[model samples]
Target: MDIQHGSGGTYRTLVDESPLSGLQWAVFVLCFLIMFLDGLDTVLIGFLAPYIGAEWKLAKGALTPVFTAGVVGLMIAGCMAGILADRVGRRPLLLAAVAVFGVANLATAYCASLEALVVLRFVTGLGLGAAMPCAVTLVSEYAPARRRAFVITSMYCGYTLGGAAVGWLTPIVAQQHGWRAMFVVGAVLPLALLPWLFWRLPESIGFLAERRRDRGAVAALLSRIVGRQVELPALPEQQKVEGNPLAIILSPAFRMRTGLLWLANGAGLLMTFTLINWLPSFLTFKHVPAQTASLSGASLQAGGAIGALLIGWLMDRFGSRKVVVGTYLGAAVASLLWIAVLDRSSAALLLMGFVAGVLVMGGQTGFQVLATSVYPVAARATGLSWMQSVGRLGGILGIQLAGMGIASDVDPISLLQALAIPALVAAVAAAFLHVTPRHVPGNAAVLKGG
Candidate 1:
């Protein structure tokens, strides 16, 4: 394998083909699977929530802490995993996360008490949380820059599809069998994929270059992808400057971008969880049947699939910031529509819900793409994980706010209206974001060697 450095700090694979030479699409498929499993794992506990409460003879509210604990665990795991991905490799981190979650999910099947269940759920969440960022980072690095947002969004469609599958499958399976079957199902599905991933999955070429080892492997991989023999530049000997994760993010160069992304992500997640976590119950309050409300929420997810695809194209053409701001503005309008006009016998409510799903859920998916692009390769995973972790905190607060508002005898419409505020704020922050790519100070060295 021949190695050459390009004009910029970018390491060029001396492959005869394009940048996305060997493993791009395969990585995308793997990422999609990871996201799908994440979706399945996340919704499984919710599907079993009612059953667990009944089995334990506990009030409905008693499980709230259990759910919150899982979210907290996920947040922590995501941050840790992101840093690890930077230090180690995305593929290994991703596989480890999946394996950990798979085993923990199986353990959930045998929980004898609420405390046991909560502990198991928290443990499973750590794996669930870590897998997503690792997959996202891998895909982002491999995908063509012009289509990066689209590819990432397309990958997440797996998540919504998995959620829909759970919605349709859980009732039938649990009714015929038992609630424990859901966790068993979740555990088995991911475990089944482990061997395939371990044998076939490729490491990120960028990561290999960063480590200054495996240059030969990177050359070969690039040659295969590009469809011809190629040479790659020699690895730079400039030691990567490692620093405190939080301090790196907060440095003057990244401060504004980081703050803007954190706010946008937090607000977007707050709106999504507030509406998604409570929409079904809110619909039931409006005299819709329980099954109908559940199905309506599923319909919203269906809309999210469409939205993700559309938003990805729009972002590629217009710009990520533009798409994000526009999507949030749309979500705010949709929320107001649901608040003012949603009622029994009004089919328009379904449309409103669907649109809300597209804008809010889809926009949040776009944020992940934006985060990946904004940070340099060395800090990419950490940047994404930090943004998501901060957003998870907002999601927790949103859940609590919705719960308290509904419990206080507040009108459901007013409660949804309150949720729209965050979307509006996200829109404002997104509008202010500039989309020019930042040049890393040391990147020029990598390019010169080529």
Candidate 2:
């Protein structure tokens, strides 16, 4: 079958009609590795905090600024890199981003002072922030609509896996070589993957079509995806979105969905990061052993990894909005149950923690999928980066709020229970996303049945 190039939607239709290709699978795997590196580097600092503090002869909490620096960098890149990707291309931006973080992580391993570490971490965050949105956008553009949400979510499962890998690697690496070794490993893996990404990673088809450049290249790429020759008609040129991409997403036509996505994604990240940062300490405060507390925290990550894939499959078969809504609501209930059973049983706490993660973490990743389905190709990277930036802000706010509560000597249980509120907020916001099958005039195909 030949892919007939016409309106923007025709490309989506062509890919949807074709079976998955080897090159498409390669794209998925490469994006997944990028995500994995993103997660490993993002969480590596946290794992190294204790070892770094001990080696530097620093007091407790001296590393807070380092954490803040990284997050601030992530937010900045999330905004800037995404807009640049839309204008330039996803492959170049992604390659540059991975190189930045890889070098930053290597530099982090040899830094002499806390201030230097903070700066390097910030740079690392910049690479990470830019890399993730571009990776997801690339995957979303390539995958068939039938499997769009699933592929994106499953690819993102690499992020959680990367985090989990750090949890295991930190203890072994730190115990033997040093905490710096963690950064070294983080650096080397992504640096090694960079060559592979450059060789294998394909540019977004939508990006090339939209720009009306490299028409031959677009045909070649589409031809490979379909395992047959793709015929080209000059794609009908569309009106250009002028000025900033952020403005386009916020324009009257897209304002409502944008607002709802911000709320849902922000609230989801708020709950996710809060629970991740505080659960172990909170469990310890309740007299759970340190080891057990760590295990409970891990259960959340494990649950999240499982939940993302399951939720994505469900979203594909059913619909994205309803599945996301249900997942967040379930997370709300799971969070409550997790904290409620804390005093009585270890097994129950672990079970509940896992369940809460399945919903909370799962639902958080689901927002990325939802964002992909909401915006058309022209402003997709901007929309995704903005949504993620808001989510990152929510994470910072949640961590800070939790810290304030602990500092003020609030009951740990009360603070833990309050985490459930964000889940409820996310659920309500997702419920209002209203992403039906109705088409906007100029927007390209979103999900066919989202």
- Give the per-residue lDDT digits (tens) of candidate 2, residues 1-450: 222233444777778778999989999999999998887788777656656767889754466667667777888999998899989989999999999999999998899998898799889989999999999999998998778888998998888778767766666678799888888999999999988888889899878876665878889988898898877875433443446778878987788878888988888887876676567666765778655665566677777888889999888887877788889778777666654687777887778767877888878888898787777787889899989987788877886777677667787778767777888898888776665334565342333344
Maximum-lDDT candidate: 2
Q: What is the TM-score of each candidate against the true structure?
A: 0.90, 0.91
Q: lDDT (CA) for every model shown?
A: 0.74, 0.79
Q: 1-450, model 1: which lDDT tens digit per residue? A: 423233332543232125654477888898899898887787666555555656788753566667666777778898899888888889999999999999998998888888887798789879988998889888877776656778999998877667656666766776678788888899999999999899878987767765665768876767667777656655446555457656777787778778888888989888866665567666766677555565566666667777888888887777777778888888887777765556545466667667777888888887887787777677878898888888888877876776676567677778777767899989988776653224554222211211
TM-score of 1: 0.90
